[model samples]
Target: MNYTLHQLQIFLKITQLKSITKASEELHLTQPAVSIQLKKFQDQFPIPLTEVTGRKLYITDFGKEIAKAAERIINEVYAINYKTMAFQGEITGLLKIAVVSTGKYVMPYFLAEFMKRNEGVELAMEVTNKARVVRSLELNEVDFALVSVLPKKLKINTVPLMPNSLFLVGSEKLEFAKNATRKKIFENLPLIYREQGSATRNAMERFITKNKLSIRKKIELMSNEAVKQAVVSGLGFSIMPLIGIKNELKNEDLHITPIKGLPIHTTWNLVWLKSKKLSPAAAAYLEFVKTNKKDLITKSFDWVKHYDKERMLVKK
Candidate 1:
């Protein structure tokens, strides 16, 4: 089939997002424009590539093969462009990343710094739970994924980026804040939990189970921001990543409830499928991350310390 690389790009995006509307938005093309290209691409093949059942889109087996091929072609094109740019002593290409929801606190700063250094690089990011991020990596929809918990089901390459410290957080006004060390305090306190399937939730659950902490009442929220807001309103105590709640604690909007066996420690990891070929941009990101990990973690810790000091001074 005679098809342009642009058509393959659109088709791959449609498969990744599973929606023409979302692909259009991501590609900065109108819905009709995306639809026209998709139709043209589909017409070249004898059998239909995709089928829509209700609002859900399903790629046929042939379509899946095409998408896999398209991804390889697209990455190879990027690799070629990267090699050409390297000859001129420049780094330029697209960098796609998928980050777990809790990574929102850290990934943006990293991206901002990396982008500043490599002005020619374009970025696309998706922030979701571990499940979706793992799926994206498996499908080659993202070049890398940032997460605290590695996917056990996949054979992936992992680089440890930093420590993810989780603590029990609550509004300072809560009675439990003053006596969080007491098991009864935890036994009596209502708990807010991250949604099921979340890495944060999984980690917290494992810790709680290991410590045998009894959560009297529990409610689940989907995002870290949501959980923080809920805790800020004194809805209940929740285990939160220290990075995510740094701002709230600094502003005195939240308090760390120092229960025993506190600060569940997990490693923040950069993961990708071992089988996927790394394009230049992706390889650069990996190297940048490897070389700069200490600085990134140090900067984050420094900020946390500054915030803690300021908050303590205010408390006095």
Candidate 2:
């Protein structure tokens, strides 16, 4: 029973991404190529490594044990490579990361600064939904993730990056006043919503349920951008994170109204699996984020203010 390092890497990536297509894209291989590698690895083990449940890929119990061993092997390999490179005085490697879609706007700025300081390092970033980001972190597919919602049962460390504000927004054509009271707003419009498993969707549901608001006739969309577009087309109103609607608010394409006594705050976090080993590059990047996160938070809030003067208006 023999398996190649490449096969292990592919299996690890598949487990991390939970999709052959995504793992292939990250590895720069075709789907067939990735499937072939994974098959070869599974053949080396007596037990099945993974199974497909509905549309999701799940690792078997035995596969989880194998993945643990594979992590140990890979960590040793990385340590050896890191020491060799250190001996040669070169600090270079790929830092693979996954970020939730809302983080897309702000993380790039911070990453650009980090790259400038560390010219030898390269980054491979995937902008994905919150569910995918959690799956990736749980499987050790990515070095780290930038997200707003943390999973409940995962033993992971999270560095608070910034505080996010969620708002209820509607199309300009909806005939709803921009300053309408929360009660009036709810009574007057149908809700537009993000699909199940979205952080925004979860937050919206909790808020609405807590306030005893009826959400029976809502149009659900899969992405924040899609939800925003639906609102622009007058499909319905939605609760969205401020990051997603900054440009629309700036251009007056969307109107926002606050819900009095609504709790809509969430903290963006830099998260990684608690027991996973970090490469030197990943560690350095984390340290960089920790040191400059205050500046990053302030800059993010600057955009928040530019889009919604009400945030500042209320502060006064």
Candidate 3:
């Protein structure tokens, strides 16, 4: 069929979202514009690629197969562009990483300089929970994953980047008596938590179990931002990563309520599956991180240590 790459792209986006209107929004095209392109793409095939029954749109089995081919063609086109840029001695290609939700805050700072130095490169990152990040590694879907911990079942290589520390945080509106105990914080406020399979949630669970701490009530949210917002609104307290709440803590929207065994520390690591071969862009990024991470951390991450020191002054 004589079809343009843009048609394949629109079809693929429609298949993924299962809604033409949503695809149009994602592609930054008007609904009518997307509809015209989709209709033009479908005209080339005798059999229907997509079918609509009432309100829902469905891609046929034939459409699913075509979507796979479209992805391969898109990758090939990208590879050609990257190869041409490399001939001119530039590090080029898409560097895709799947990061745990809280890692979104940490990875961007590391990426900013690398991206600036290599103008030919492009970035794609999926910020999700730990389980999805690990699944992406298993599928070889991404070049790297940023996590504070990796599952023992996965054989992977790791590059330790910086410390990831979690603290028990509450809304600044929380008030305590002059001699209030740490246990009182738990008693006074409901606990907000990230959903299951989140590394933060797992760590919080371990701490609670070991200390035999009783949570009076809890609210489960799916993301770090959600939990933080809940805590900021005085709905509850949560065990949140220090990196993700620096600004909130500074603005006095949240407070690191000093819990006895808190500020659990782990090293944030960049990991990739051992069996997956690295692309040139991925390899270049690996080298850059290895060479510059120490200096980068010192320059940009001094706030973490400074915050820790200041937190110590919040007594029992």
In candidate 3 the C-alpha lDDT for residue 30 amounts to 99
Misplaced by over 4 Å in model 3 are 1-3, 30-32, 39-49, 61-69, 119-124, 135-141, 153-155, 172-178, 273-276, 298-302, 311-315
The digit string of per-residue lDDT tens for model 1 on 101-176 reads: 9998888867777888887688999999988898898888989999898888889999887778887778866664
TM-score of model number 3: 0.83
* Candidate 1 Cα outliers beyond 4 Å, as residue runs: 1-89, 177-181, 304-316
All models: lDDT? 0.84, 0.81, 0.89
Question: Model 1: what TM-score?
Answer: 0.69
TM-score, one value per model: 0.69, 0.68, 0.83
Candidate 1 C-alpha error for residue 82, in Å:
8.6
Tens-place lDDT per residue, model 2, 1-316, is 7898888888988888889999999999999999999998998878999999898899999998888888889978876776676777866677989998778876786788888876567688998788988888888899998888888878998888777778777776887665655666676688987777678888998888877776537788888788889888888888888877777887888977556644388888888888978887788898999899888767656767554445422200
lDDT string for model 3 (106-215, tens) is 99989999999998899999999999999998889999999998778889999999989999888866666656666776766688989999999999999888877777
Residue pairs of candidate 1 with colliding backbone atoms: none
Q: Pick the candidate with the highest lDDT.
A: 3
